[model samples]
Target chain A: MHSQTPTCGSIPPVPARAGIGGKPAHYAELLAARPPLAFVEVHPENYMGEGGPPHAYLEVIAEIYPLSFHGVGMSLGSSGPLDRGHLARWRKLIDRYEPALISEHIAWSRVGEVCLHDLLPLPYTDATLKLVCRHVEEMQLVLGRRILVENPSSYITPKDSAIPEADFMVEVATRTGCGLLLDINNVFVSATNNGFDPRAWLARISGHLVQEIHLAGHATIRSGELELRIDDHGSPVCDDVWDLYRETIARIGPRPTLIEWDTDVPELPVLLGEAARADAAAALSESPHAAVA
Target chain B: MLPLHEFQAAMASYLSSPPGPDVSHHLKSMMRPSLRSVERRLAVYKNNVYARLVDALRDSFPAVERLVGEDFFRYAAVQYVSITPPKSPTLLGYGKDFARFLENFRPRRIFPIFPMSPISSSVTSKPITRQTRFPSASSGASETATACCCIRLPVF
Candidate 1:
C-alpha cells in the first residue's frame, strides 16, 4: 500500500487566484505570454497516454506554472474496488508532474469491469457511503498524498437516497480526511434542479475542508416539468453562476479556483480573460470595496 | 414491491427491447407514474439515453455518420446499441465497435466505397483519434486485420 509522506515541506502553498483548464490549442501562446494565472487544471485522462503532444506541452507549461490533475474517470463512488491500472497510470503522472493538487469526482462512472462514460449518480445511502470512503482511502494510499473530491452536478435524484448531499460529503471528508474541490457552479445547478437553496448548501460546506474550487457553465434541459441544468462545461460561465461563485468565495475566502471551459473551448485569451474576471472578483471580496458594493 | 435487482433487470430489459410490447407491461407495474408518467414517458428516458449515445458517436465519428447519412446513421446506431450496449459509462469511450459493424453490415455495403474516401479522411483529422482508430475495409482483409489489432492495442 502506498503512503503519503508530507511533501508540503518544499512545495509552496497553493496560490489563492484563478486559472483555466489547459487545452492543447492554447499551449504555446499561454507559455509565451505567461499570462497571470495561478495554475492550470488538466483532465488526468487526457494525459494518461504515453509520451506525446499532451506531455510535451504540459512539461513546458509546468516549468513556468503550477498544475493540478482533475480526473473525471476514477469512478470513486462505484461499488467496486479501485482500478489498479488507472491508479498506476495516475501514480506515474503524479510522479512526473508532481501536481500541486489531485482531485476526482464524488460520483461513479463504472460498475464491475464495465465503464460508464457518464459521471452517474450514487444513492446517498450507507452502503454507497462506505463504498466511496473505502475507494477514497485506497486512492489516497496509492497517490501517497491526500486528494480532493468534487461534488458532481447530478441530473436525477436517486430513489434510494438517504442523506442530504452536503451531509453525505461532510461525512466522507470526516471519515477519509480527503479535502473538497467545491465546484460553485455545481452547487447552483444541483440546488436549482433539486429545489434546494444554493446559499444554504454553501453554508453547509465552507472553510478548511474545501481546498479548491471549480466554476463552469451548464445547459438547462426540461425533463417533464422539472428543468434540470446539465453541467455541460461547454460555454461561458453564466452571470448567475458567476454571482454564486463570488458569494461562495467571499464567504469562504479564496482557494485555488479554476475556470473550466471544456466543449466549445475559446482562444487562450478568452479563457485567461475569464480567469482574470474570477481573480478580480476574489480580489474584490478580499478588498474593502466589496463591502461598499 | 419489486426488489432492486428486479428493478435493474426491468430497466435493462426496457432499454434493450424498448419498442417491444413487453416493456410497457413491465414498466407499468414497476415505475411510479409520478416518477415517470407512463410507459410512453419511460420510452422518452430510453430515447434520451439512445439519443445522447448516438449524438456522442456522431460527434466522435462525424465522417462515418456523414458517409452513412443521418437517417441511415440513426438506424445503424439503433442496431449497434442493441448488439453492443455501451460498456463504459462514458459515452465518449463507447462506439468502439461501430466502425467494425459498418464493415460487416450488408445494407451499407451497397455504398461500397463509403468506408474510405471522405469518412475515414475526416476522422483522421479530428482531435478525438485517441478514442478510436477506425479502419478502412478497402485496404484488404489481412491489412484490415492488422489495423484492427493495432487499433485495439490499449493506450495505457
Candidate 2:
C-alpha cells in the first residue's frame, strides 16, 4: 500500500510574478536559461506515468524552480464521486515534488462514467455548490493542503442558473476553505461570450482567497450565424485580456500569474516573452502609486 | 428548477450528438431567453465539445487524419466517438484506440495504412523484420521500424 504519510519537507512558495505553462519542448531551454520565473505550473497528469523524459525533465526543473501541480481531471464539480485512482496518482506527484500550489477547475467534465476532457460549464445552483464543496473538502483532506478551484471559460451559460458564476466561485471558496485560481483570461472570455462586465466579476469574487492567476489565449469559432469564443488556448493572450489582467492584478495585488499557451506553442522564446510581459504587467500593480486605500 | 444531474445528462447527450426530437422537447424549455431558438444556443456547446474531441484525435492520428483529409478525419472521429467515447477525464491519452479503429474501419482499408507488414507502435528501434518489402511511397508508409515520437510506425 502506498503511504499516505507526507514525508517531504516544506517547499518555498511561488513568487508573485510570472510563470509559463511547463511544456516539454521548452524543458531544456528552461533548464539552461533558468529565467526569472516565480514557478512553473504543469498539468500533473502529464507526468503521472512511470520513469520517462517527462519526469526526468520535471525532476531537474523542480530542483531549481518551485513547481505548481495544476490538475485538470479531478472533476470537482461532478455530481458523481471523485476518481480515487486519479487522486492517488496526483498525491504521488505532490508528495514527491512538494509543489507550491495545487489547483483544479470549478467545471464538470464527467458524469457517471462518461469522461469528456473538455472543461464543461456547471450551473450556478445550490446543488452544484454543495457537490463542489464536498469534493473540494475531500480533496483538501486527502491532499493535506487547500486546493484552489479555477473558474472555467464557458461558451454557453446553462439555462436557469440561479447563482452568478463569480458568486458560485466565492461560495465554493468560502465553504471549502479553499482558494481561487482566478484565471483572468477566463473572466474575459466568459464575459465576452456570455456578455458580462469582467471588472464587476472581480468585485463579486472573494479576492483574498485568490492564490494564483492564469492568463491564457482563446480562439474564436463561428457556429451557425452566431460567433462564439472558445477557450482554445491556441494563441497569444489578446490585448483586451491583457488589459483585464492588469486591472485584476491592481485589485488582487501581485499574484503568481501563469501564461498558458497550450496549442501551436511557439518557440520557448515566445512563451518566455509572454511571461516577461506578464511580469511587467503585475509589476505595475505592485507600484506604490497603484495601491488603493 | 431542473434536476442538476438530469440537466447535465441532457447537455452531455447533446454535446455527443445533435439532440433528438424527444430529448430536445423537454430540455429546451428549461433554458433562458426562451425567445431565441434553444437549438441554436445549444449548438455552441455542441461545436465546442466535438471540435475539442476531434482535435484530440487529430493529434493522435495525424497521419491517419492527414491521409484522409480534414473532412474524412472528422467523419472518422464522429464514428469513433459513437463507437468508443473517451473513458478518461484528461485528453492526454484519449485516442489510443483510433489507430486500430482506422485499420478496421472499412473506408480506410482502400488506403492500406497497414500493408501486409503490420507496423505496430513499438518504442524500440529494432526493425520489425530483417527482410522488408518497402511499401510504395504513395502509401505514406515505410517498412522500416522507425520510432517517431515514441510511436514506432512504418512511416515514409
Which stretches of candidate 1 lie above 4 Å from their native place? A1-8, A288-293, B1-63, B74-78, B85-97, B109-156
Quality of candidate 1's docking, in CAPRI categories?
incorrect
Off by over 4 Å in 2: A1-9, A291-293, B18-23, B34-41, B62-71, B91-93, B109-119, B122-156
TM-score for all models, in order of appearance? 0.79, 0.84
Who wins the DockQ comparison? 2
Q: Which of the CAPRI classes, incorrect, acceptable, medium or high, describes model 2?
A: incorrect
In the range B1-156, model 1's lDDT, one tens digit per residue, is 343334444455565552332455654665433343344434434554454455556655666677678878877777776667665332334666567777677777677556443234232322222222222122111000000000111111
Give residue A139's error in model 1 in angstroms: 0.4
Candidate with top lDDT is 2
DockQ of 2: 0.20
Interface RMSD, in order shown = 10.8, 10.3
Tens-place lDDT digits, model 2, residues A138-240: 8887788778889888766777688999999988887777889998888987887787898888788766988999888877756466665666676789998
